[model samples]
Target: MYCDESGFTGNDLLDQGSTYFAYASVAINHEEATEYVNNIIQKYKLQGGELKGRNLLKSTKGKKVIAEILSTFKDRIKVGVYHKKFNLACKFYEYIFEPPLSEKSSLFYQIKFHRFISNILYLDFVCRSEEAEKIFSDFQNLMRKKPNYLFSSSETPDMSPLDDIKTFCIHHRDTINQELNSLQGTDIGKWILELSTSALFSILCDWGKEFNQLKVFCDVSKPLKENKELFDVWIGIKDKIYFDFFQGVEEPITFNLSQEVQFVESDKFPGIQIADVAAAACAYAFKEGVNQNTESWIEHIPGMVIGKSVIPDESYTDPNTLDATRNLILLRYLAEKSINKQPLLDGIEEFLSAVTHDLNLNPSNRIATIAENSRSDAPYFNF
Candidate 1:
């Protein structure tokens, strides 16, 4: 299958003009994807270079082409969406990293995104500066790697790598700004990431059930380096993603990276183009706030969507605000068990306790045991 996203702003996720971020992916029925792409190119007289979604969604003819494409491939597409606000995310991080960084606010309360995000929060929000040199250190000396078979039973308490934070928050209660309540925070890129990977793994999970390997393709967002390839920009989901079903009693469903997944220019493959169309269409649907004709293109792209910000349910979501805990979990994007396909809401603790999942010479997945001294005013994050 192929996957791609619309409305990517890198760290510019909180820009208000970009209200929503979406990821869309299509299954790899190669012959059918090719046939559809050819029909669209011939029908629209599209020049051979590429058929990008943003361009295709701009014209009346393009709209017709999109509508027809939707009509043709509705079942093969999947989408996930998130609405974000950067300001709110900043505030939440501040509140977490604010003064009184002890007790519950210790290393136990947060998932550092496999050590990628803790410094961002600790330095940026909490106003602590010790190392401009070891800025790349893995935040925790985690005990294990990604948890695929850890949860053998639902009856097992959700003792994930992320459990420490949940437990700390539940017990300490006042470590963060509890009143700054919102379901999702403004860290839009992370939210986009959360949405994108979830979209991919949902397919991986279902395919895992069938014991079938699925290859993933995504549109190229970065300039291709001559010899090196960017790996797993999305954490938790590495070159491979796996999850155990049936309470971990069954063999885990596993998927790998690079060889199993390919990142390509949109022009070379028909599937990526369609995924582009589908991703943009999803962005439009969320903005329109209605699923009628203007938004009908989404009807053609079928897949589960998480973090739907359109619902008026303030009980959990408010497009205009930020909720402390949710945003924290979101920024890390590594607290859930992709291996067991377990709910990621608790995956951070597992991530905190995990180690050595990487199989290569370059240890990009840096992990460790870390417990910052919350109250020692000396600014201690001694690894």
Candidate 2:
């Protein structure tokens, strides 16, 4: 039950339509998971230098300070570097320290910098799930090929899972603070807080089996408001069935109701607005798809199950959407847990008919105008 969210927008608060938020929850077997991770960390450390106080991008030029620290550990600590744009220097300054630092600021800078780097490294490690083994292998191979540019680090000292997670959040908070001071006109702090919240949610989802049975629900809006008529069919069915099925459960269920609010000022649909909604929708869809197969008494029903529901105008086509769709269909066969699919399908059909009847009764109000101006210069693509 691990849930996490990522914002595509630079400023989550001020920047309205340009930002996107993505939330995901994954469940993984816990038996020996921590030990496995620790083992991986140890293996990484033994190849080179010591594990304590290592920087993420040590090999990068801007992080020469980090390189120096690692030099002490030598071959005892092994650092894994991802050679992308090599923007470590920019990110370092951007995520740590204010301008015009005096000699006295060295200690302050070091503390903040180490915490930030450690968290980033930890995240990079956690995100490497079995599904991403190929990507990790490829990345490792790339690092091997570019020997000079590759960076690596030893694992953090042993700690409980909760403690390690809290440490990660605290470091994230420090990094966000640094970003707030160095960058202008944005509430990066709030964004990080949201990320932390989302991350905690993901962690819970990952370990959901340990908790009492919980049902998680999410919404998928239409691409255009006018398409609401189409979207309503599915939404209506879901609402009816969900409420009917779990109207008064003793245990509370979790509902993740996310709506993409447009930030653009123009009457026409903005690219940013569409991108944001689309990203959130995809994240929700993917999580549902994955969990549908893995959790008993949990169902994964796509908005399409209701039929003709117009997704919000803010929703746009993205690779994640297709991935989510594919996963949902595959879950029927690949999931380790068994679910009662008949109720879900029956609910879908009933809701679809009811919604279709309602739409027909009010043709004029059925269409919704998502934007003040309908036309846009932006290119349109289907998800």
Candidate 3:
């Protein structure tokens, strides 16, 4: 597969106006991609170079070419989309509340906890833009250090990022917010916040499992190039079981990946150019909303897209609806492994019960459930 990304704002995700990030992997060989590019160039009487996706989306002819390419090779393409704001919230919750960074796991993580936390943060960031901006700014600063950052400090910890989060939670003491108070004066270490590397690996894992082996070609990406060794370790992870310390739940994931990727220039590889177009177009469709120009592209995306945005539109979700709540639980479960089904269901029920109580307290407030409220009827493909 050939890969490329679009709308990458690096770690500066909040202010860049690049609300969505997309990484696309196209399953077309070099010869086919080359032929298609040559044909398009000859047919359109256009300049021959790297057929940039961003440029292609500009004009009627370019858009037509993109539409044709998408329609022609819809099944062979796989795109991963990330809602930047939601993604940032998820990162914050994961680092502060889950796994190696945080000492213990929270029961909330199992039952749409990430979403719950993200919704709260998302709202705070949206409603209180200045304060929200500072939170992200502090977070970006905190993540630039070497040596493991400590979360449980005996001495006074740097409170820039941690305090920002705590202040937000303390100001509004809800269930999720109060839970965030655990990291009041702690720190989360440096983690590469870019989406491309992880997204590419996920696509590789899925494709690798299907093909048993893959000869991958990625357009020269700094993250992919720098984290080559990390990718190797991730694919061949021996300890597949990641235990949730809070619930004593062991989530085991087995990967069938066994290959190294080759990072090449898009100018030399037509396949990578095709991936570029697909990724850029996909990101644009989501970020700009599906209009007449983007509707055709959306039609080709449903099954091919492997998206991470649990909540596409924050407000469209109806938290009071049991079905919506159930779907979120289901999506979370399906995305990760659950060895014990009954307890998981019980957990979901407990969360729902708590939601009911919370709703009764403030009937005017709408809870954010997972909803597909994009301009087009494009389905979200999780996992």
**Global lDDT scores for all candidate models:** 0.45, 0.27, 0.61
Q: Candidate 3: where are CA atoms >4 Å away?
A: 99-106, 145-191, 234-258, 307-383
Regarding lDDT, does 2 or 3 come out ahead?
Answer: 3
Q: Per-residue alpha-carbon lDDT of model 3 for 1-383, expressed as tens digits? A: 89999998876667566778889988887898999988887887767666899898888888888988899889888888888877777776665444321322443555455555455456556655554555555555544432332222223322222233443333222333344444444321223466776787667655644464467788887767766765666444433333443346443233333466788998899999888988889888887777988876677877778633233454323455543344343334422322222322346556567765765565443333333211112122111
Per lDDT, the best of the predicted structures is 3
Greater TM-score among 2 and 3 belongs to 3
lDDT, residue 326, candidate 2: 22
- Residues 252-358 of candidate 1: C-alpha lDDT, one tens digit per residue: 33443325356687767888888888778777776775544466465544444532222122222211122222333343332233324444344444443342222
Estimated TM-score for each candidate = 0.48, 0.22, 0.68
Candidate 1 global lDDT: 0.45
Candidate with more favorable, higher lDDT: 1 or 2:
1
Quote model 2's TM-score.
0.22
lDDT of 1 at 60: 74
Count clashing residue pairs per candidate. Answer: 34, 44, 0
- Candidate 2: list runs displaced more than 4 Å: 1-31, 42-383
